[model samples]
Target: MDWSEIIARSEKSFWGLLGLRMLSADSKLVELGLTVNESHLNSMGIVHGGVLSSMMDQAMGTLVTAIKNGSQGVTTHLNVNFLSAMRSGELIASAYPLHETHRTMTLRSEVRGEDGTLACISTATFRLPRDSK
Candidate 1:
């Protein structure tokens, strides 16, 4: 699918207000790009943890979706490590599948600033739904 279609679909399906454009996606790898707007800022004018968590989730979920056939999954657990502050600007996140089984998938992601500084690292576990069809 095209970038516009991906963005639209993600926004509708995930309620992700931020326009996280997919830069690339393939088996085992996915890259997402986003810009922090005012809505994403916290009271301190820095990006909130929730926003970073959402971005991490999206990156990890998109990686899982690329590998799965017809099944979908929901995040069962997420662990995040914040390294540095993220101010309002552009950022990129890359996610890859670290491990996968019949029922579960684990993904590792790193959020980086425009200057290539590491902002955060995250891991997420998703429980794959049983295919009914």
Candidate 2:
């Protein structure tokens, strides 16, 4: 399925923005892009950290979803590193599966600004469903 169809079937808040297009997806990777707006800004006038985190989470989770074998999972942990400020404009986030086991999966993601500068990096762990039938 396409990104729009995936969003329509999932609970993704940021999916409402048309900017978030799926550049690619496969059994091991997922990529999404977004355009920052006023709503994404914080008191400092830069993109909010929460928004960045959410996007990172979504990208990483999508990677996990693609690798899983007809099972769903919940994020168990997320580690993020903010390298630079995300200005209000266009940006891209890409994720890839680091590892996957019978009960867990690990993913890594990076957020890049419109200029292709690294804004943030993240790693997430998810617990797979026990009944993965």
Candidate 3:
């Protein structure tokens, strides 16, 4: 889907409130972009870890949904590692599947700053509904 379509699809959701934009998406990878704003900052003036974590989660979930042809799943586990601090500018989060079975899919994702510094990395597993299997 195009960016506008993606935005329209999610505009009323939390991702839209965070200003996440779909940079690109395919069966293998999905990239999401976000411009760091005041609302995303923590008390220390750095981007909050939760913001990055949410981006990674969204990226992984989006990819899994696409791979399953719109079958949605629940995140069973999510592990995030904060690698660097970011104060401003933009961030891009990308995700792809690492493994999958009839009812579970695991994905790896990373978020990088505009300068290409890796800010966060994560892996998540989603459990598809029994009917989606």
Compared with the true structure, model 3 gives a TM-score of: 0.93
lDDT of 2 by residue, 25-98 (tens): 77777888888888888999988888888788878877766666435579999999999998777888899888
Query: Regarding TM-score, does 1 or 2 come out ahead?
Result: 1
Ranking by lDDT: 3, 1, 2
TM-score of each: 0.88, 0.86, 0.93
Identify the superior model by lDDT, candidate 2 or candidate 3: 3
TM-score for candidate 1, please give it.
0.88
Clashes of 3: 0
lDDT of 2 at 4: 56
Give the distance in Å from residue 24's predicted Cα in candidate 3 to where it truly belongs: 0.7
* Per-candidate clashes, comma-separated: 0, 0, 0
Q: Between candidates 1 and 3, name the one with more favorable lDDT.
A: 3
Model 3 misplacement above 4 A = 1-7
The candidates, ranked best first by TM-score, are 3, 1, 2
Q: Model 3, 31-89: lDDT tens per residue?
A: 99999999999999999999999999999998987787777789999999999999999
For 39-67, candidate 1 gives per-residue lDDT tens digits of 88899988888878888888888777777
On the 0 to 100 scale, the lDDT of residue 78 in model 3 is: 99
Q: Which TM-score value belongs to model 2? A: 0.86
